[model samples]
Target: MDLHGPLRDASDTILASRAIDGDLVAFEVIAHRHGPLMRVLAANLLGSELESDDVVQEAFISAWRHLGELNDPARIRSWLMRIVSNRALDRIRARRHHDDIDAADRASTGPSTEALVEHRMQLDAVWIALGRLPADQRRCWLLRETAGYSYAEIGETLDIPVSTVRGLLARARATLLLEMEAWR
Candidate 1:
């Protein structure tokens, strides 16, 4: 279809409302807009970029089937992300064993050695800092920063108060900044 048309420029709420009404083109637009990010989330959770496509595909399928059930059309991006994470987790649980290879290494490509090394070190520091955070704080930070979730959305997803989400994110950010500064 003409993806360059006005539909592509529509807001997530508009697109999601259209999709709920069985508008295939609108649904396609939503998929196209969110697919790459969904796949990235899946790959990170699954630790296999190759399998991430299937996980995202399953998420889309599930999303299509349940679009009518979504309470807020504006939150469709987070909704799709939740679906992909669930699907990826399901796949991980289904696997008999796990591979030793890291998905991050596989996903990285074409950077110069120096650039790659520096980037990797920075990423490692962030991960180490993330690891040291309290579980709730880490989760809140990840949902807010990595998943791009709003505080209210993170609160809803975690069944916590919005104030709690804010506090967790604040503490997580402060700790992470301290850790990263130490690393630097």
Candidate 2:
């Protein structure tokens, strides 16, 4: 069977089933269908093109391994997205920890010039403001505002209840608005 040809007719459930049955071609179709969205999600979360690619690859591998465990085949998109989210979260945590270690080292070594330190401090302030947001709110804001995901699509991708997505997005906007007003 030419997997590509069948994929066009196959629903996500069908493709997922075939993939779980060891059909690599079927899995490839699933990957292709979802890859662009995955990249966008990863890039938004990681904030680096190269790191996003790494996160997406890891997510795909994870999906393949856990394919059999998916309860609702039709919900494959959301399941895959959840995997991507988890992977991205892991990457973000590691990056933040690395940054903290570097900052500690830099402090011990004496700070850079006053101008450079001031610029960095401003950047840190923005980052701290963003970091204060709840994870769901942050993810929703990033996916919708930065990644250009629509509400429904984001709800699907994040495996969030649509109402929950709306609430989180609203909260995020409120937070940003307050922060911006303070800056002014």
Index of the highest-TM-score prediction: 2
| Candidate 1: pairs in clash | none
- Summarize candidate 2's per-residue lDDT along 1-184 as a digit string, tens digits: 4544848678998988888888888889888888888888888777788888888999999998888898887888878877887798778666643444345446756655564556556655656776889878877887787577889888888777889999999998899878756555
Query: Candidate 1, which segments miss by more than 4 Å at Cα?
Result: 96-184
- Model 1, 1-184: lDDT tens per residue? 8999999899999999999999999999999999998887777666689999999999999999999899988888878877887787568656623522344346557555566567667866776787688878876787677567789878876657999998999999888888888656
Q: Alpha-carbon error at 90 in model 1, in Å?
A: 0.7
Model 1, poorest ten-residue lDDT window? Answer: 96-105
Candidates' C-alpha lDDT: 0.81, 0.79
lDDT score for residue 43 of model 1: 78
State each model's C-alpha RMSD to the native.
9.2, 5.3
TM-score of each: 0.58, 0.66
- Candidate 2, run of 10 with poorest lDDT: 96-105
Q: Which whole-number lDDT from 0 to 100 does residue 34 have in model 2?
A: 88
